[model samples]
Target chain A: MTDIAGSATRVADIQAAYLAQARSKRVMNLILIVIFAALLIAGFRTADRRNAGGFWDGLPNILDFPADVIGEAIERAHLLPGYLIKYLPSLIETINIAGASTLLGAMAGLVMSLLVTRGLGPVPWLVGPLRRVLDILRAVPEIVIALVLIFMLGGGPVPAMIAIALHTTGALGKLFSEVNENASLRPVEGLASVGATWTQRMLLGVVPQVAPNYLSYALLRFEINIRASAILGFVGAGGIGYDLRNTMSWGAGKFDEAAAIFLLLFLSIVAVDQMSSILRHRLTHGAKPGEIHR
Target chain B: MSAQALHQQTRRNFNRKRLMSFALPGLVLGYFAYIFMAFDMAGLGVRVNLENARTLVSDAYSYKTHVTQDNRTGAVEIAIEGERKGAYAPGTAPGWVRLGETSEIDLGGGHVVTFGGRVTYDVPGYGLVMAEPGAGGVNASLPDGALPDFISLSKNRLMVKTDAGRLTVTRNRAEVFKYSLGWELFFFTLDSPYHGMSPGALFKAAVNGEAGAIWQGFVGNKMWRHGDVGWALLETVLMAFLGTCGAAIIALPLGFLAARNFTPLGGLRFAARRMFDFLRGVDGLIWTIVLSRAFGPGPLTGSLAILLTDTGSFGKMFSEALENVDARQVEGITATGARPLQRYRFGVIVQITPVLLSQVLYYLESNTRSATIIGAITGGGIGLLLTQAINTQKDWEEVSYYIVLIILMVMLMDSVSGWLRRKLIKGNGGGH
Candidate 1:
């Protein structure tokens, strides 16, 4: 009976200690939360001070521009379809830029992935340098290259295409190489034993294994490239974004045109977003029984 | 199934595969062909400006010093890149330039230019080209031979280009541009006493208590504006940090609202989901444009733009993560007699915090790059500086400098975020 009583006392002491630790942990977390909140408040204030207009003052006016555009667009709704039709070619140009760049970039990225992947690389020493190359390519904002190219190429879709492609290559190369790492090397070794060249082994053995994932990643990149291409056009690379900028700069009288362009961009982005997601879903999880082998 | 039937099926599948392989390549080829015409690749060759390319490439590595003489005032000025900020003070010139009544510029390969009443260029191979700027025109004479293509002569302007330098004499002024390697006035402007100090000497001076002075000179350098660039970089990082963190903070609760398991009311869930979709569909470029309209082109607008766009993305991702959370943990918390908020705090939040934090951190690094691009459009951060430098056309050295800094900044952020991710999510399934 004395032993049981002693053990019960020890158990109560241990529970008290655990409660103390938990309470202290809660206090520490609360302190952290307070500090984080303080930082957020301070950051917002600093940003407000640095901004040209105050946030509170600007908040009310946030919807003003959109409303004006919508109101003007509604009044001139008759010209909306005509404007959309007129700008259809520009929209197509933008989509074409994205598609072409994605294609070119994916091809470059595929080769790079093959060259850089651990088990599949032709030269081990080249991997580090090639990875750094991709990192630099990815690091550079497309505007930097696009603007520079615009200076040299005299303003066209080509500069935007090249800039976006370079970036996409870097992005997709990293993703593709990651996918390549998970691929089975058995087929590659078998092909190598049969005296297949490096390129043939990669194309026939590794490519088939990772093609679905690569396609999915490339499709996602294409979606991103579409937005990038549009933004590039805003900086004078030529497309719907250029038209939007033109209409925007014209300001008051051209709100309807701006609205039309905005609608087109919105619809296209949403459409592409939906289509790519669906396609990626299918590629990843909906592979047919026979498709897996290929 | 018989072996003959299986063989027939295999043959049919191989034929289909063969047909698909050919068709895929053909389709891709056709698309490329269409793009070629659509993007006008044929006209691209004609559209390219080789001269601009040469200038951009050469100017990125070299700077030209301008020696100009005003015909109206009889005053001579020497400036780097012909910028007023880079102009040399009176009675001061580079060692290569001898300042006197007639300034003699040594263009190094035995090529010398003397600027006086008449500008004389002594070319090593082509002899002398002399030009006199007058009220009527630039009376000019070149070496007596077939006039070389390098020399462009006219009634009003006489331009003599050589391997070492270029001299142009006009009706109002005579200017000589001598090219040199490296970015001049990068560390110190002409006004700084430490302008031409060697590294060894500068270090010695710094050791001898002139460190603050030297640092001030460099930071306040008018040509490079290191102080301004540093601030711009900080502002960019700040935008990213505030945007990403702010978005995560705002989206966390909204994610709960959108999650089907958490929010029982389907109407609220639908509203939250559609709100996220609307925010995302508008895109960052549009948000930047719209926000900049209100905030008037600054870092705040940039941050807000990023915040809004990322909120949508984070909302969707966070909701998905919340939905996938193990329900047993929440049930156990409830069994402990915890309140609803406390249960969620220990259950769902604890479970998804790693995923949420990792995603937020990943976006932080990417948002740094996005902030740069947005900053360009909104006229904030390093992007603004980069765009402004590039727009100046002759500041390719500065452009290169900004580009290098931007790449370094991004790489630094990438490594930092990657390190944090490893440290924070090491044993968690969230590890990349």
Candidate 2:
């Protein structure tokens, strides 16, 4: 009977401890939620105040610009094809900028990745400095370089291409190095034992293993670069975006052209996005067992 | 399969791989050749401005002080960057300049310029070049021999360019530019009381209870605008914070509706998925343009643009996460007779919070960069200041300052978000 009573007291003590712990956890969660909510509200208020137009006042008019563009396109439906054809060259230029930059950046990134990866690199001391170089390249927004280059090189596709390519180099270098870290070192070691140079080893051994992943990442970067190229164009780097800005600046009467350009841009972006996604999916997952490989 | 057939297949694969290895690079090369022509590479040499490049690079690290003598008034004044705000008092000048009726500027390295009755530039290798400005236009005299390439002489104006300094004399004004190696008025403007105070002196002053006054001057500096820069940085971070958290909050429920496992209604799921695609397809640039129309340019527009674009991304990722969640937990909760809401809260949200939090945090870091770019377009944040400074085309030092701050800001955010992700993910793992 005494042993049963002692066991009962122990059970009671365990329940009290659990309940107290749960209550404190609940209080802590509540405090965090309250603080988060307060921050959100305060941030919104500050943003609204700083904005040129208040949020509530501007909220209702959000659809006005889109509506105007759509309405103008509908009215000038016949001229839409002409506008599209007229701007196709610029669109192609934008796409070309993206493609060229992606290609160049990926090649540079591949080499840099090999140089920065531990055990795979020829010179071990280069890793830290190269990593910091990549960091700086990634940190600088394309606009900064593009604008500066535009001042020197004048408004054109080259400045935008170089700027975007430099950024892509940094971004892809870091990502590729991370992929390299997970890659098998056996192939590199085997090639090294055979007196193969760093370049030969990396190209012959490592590249084959990581090519699919690199291609997938490069494809994703291409999609991003297309958008970046368009933006750079808006800032006077020569492309469809420059035309868009011109049409938009003309306002009211020329919105039809703007709408057509918008349609072209939107459609092309979606097309590339879809294509890249499918390709990336295939690259990452591979084909079915019975299917022939690319 | 026979050994002969298998061997043939292997041989064919090798041949195809070898063909691909050559053809792929060839294709890329062909494309680049085309781009070279399309982007006008051949003509780029003629279009390129080496002078502008030199100015941009040089001005980025150095500043020039101007010693001017107004031809009309015959009054001399010294100023940094020739800005009225950076001008010294009538009786005051930098240590390198001796103030008098005839001010003498030591440009260093045996190069000197005297702004007095007649502007005289003393070059080390070249002889003294003198120019007097009056109503009849610049009356100039150079060395007896042929004029050097550095000097550009015209009827109304005379200009001399040297490594250490440059001199320009016109009918209206005569000015000498003395290049220096550091940014001027960076810490404190000419108007500030502590304009040239050393750190030790500043510390001593602070101890003497003048700290607040000194800080006020530094923060309120018209040239550097330290206070404004601090606020701009905060705004940029706020944009990333508001956008990421707001998207996460808005995407959670939409994610549930879109998830195959959570929602039985096929039509609702399809609609939600399509919405996500449409939002993501629109692109942040277009969204920035559209939002800026209604909201005008500011942090609000930038944040909203980020929010709208990220909402689709987060929704799609979240739904994918939700679909992959284990059903066993939900079944266990249902066994306890839990309501649908309670089942989701205890079962689904708990499991996916780590994934969702990590994705959101990662985006928070990237969005800081996006915010900066958007801010440039929308006319807000440090990006706006940078663009404005660049447009002016003379304030390269200011541009460099903003660039450094932007880089530091991005790196800081990157590290902070990374740390938070590691902490939260590990915390969740341990709790389970």
Count of residue pairs whose backbone atoms collide, per candidate: 0, 0
Candidate lDDT values, in order? 0.89, 0.89
| iRMSD per prediction, in order | 5.7, 5.8
Candidate 1 colliding pairs, count: 0
lDDT of 2 by residue, B1-432 (tens): 999999999999999999999999999999999999999999999999999999999998999999888878888888899999899988888999987777888999999888877888899888899888887778899889987899999989999999999899999898889899988888899989898889999999999999999999999988778999988988888898999899999999999999999899999999999998888888888898899999999999988999998898899889988897889999999999999999988988889888788789888888888888888888788778888989999999988899999999999998999998888788666223
Per-residue C-alpha lDDT of model 1 across residues B25-81, encoded as one tens digit per residue = 999999999888888899989998999999999999999999999966768899999
Candidate 2 chain B, poorest ten consecutive residues by summed lDDT:
B423-432
RMSD of each: 3.4, 3.0
Model 2 lDDT, residue B81, Cα: 92
**Which residue ranges in model 1 land beyond 4 Å of their true spot?**
A1-35, A286-294, B71-74, B132-139, B207-209, B427-432
Model 2: fnat (fraction of native contacts): 0.63
Candidate 2 structure quality by residue, lDDT tens digits, A1-294: 999999999999999999998899789879989999999999999988888988999999999999999999999999999999999999999999999999999999999998999888789999999999988888888898998999999999999999999999999998899889889989988998999987899999899999898998899899889989998899899999889889988989899999988888889999998898889888989522111100
DockQ of each: 0.47, 0.49
Question: B-chain TM-score, every candidate?
Answer: 0.95, 0.96
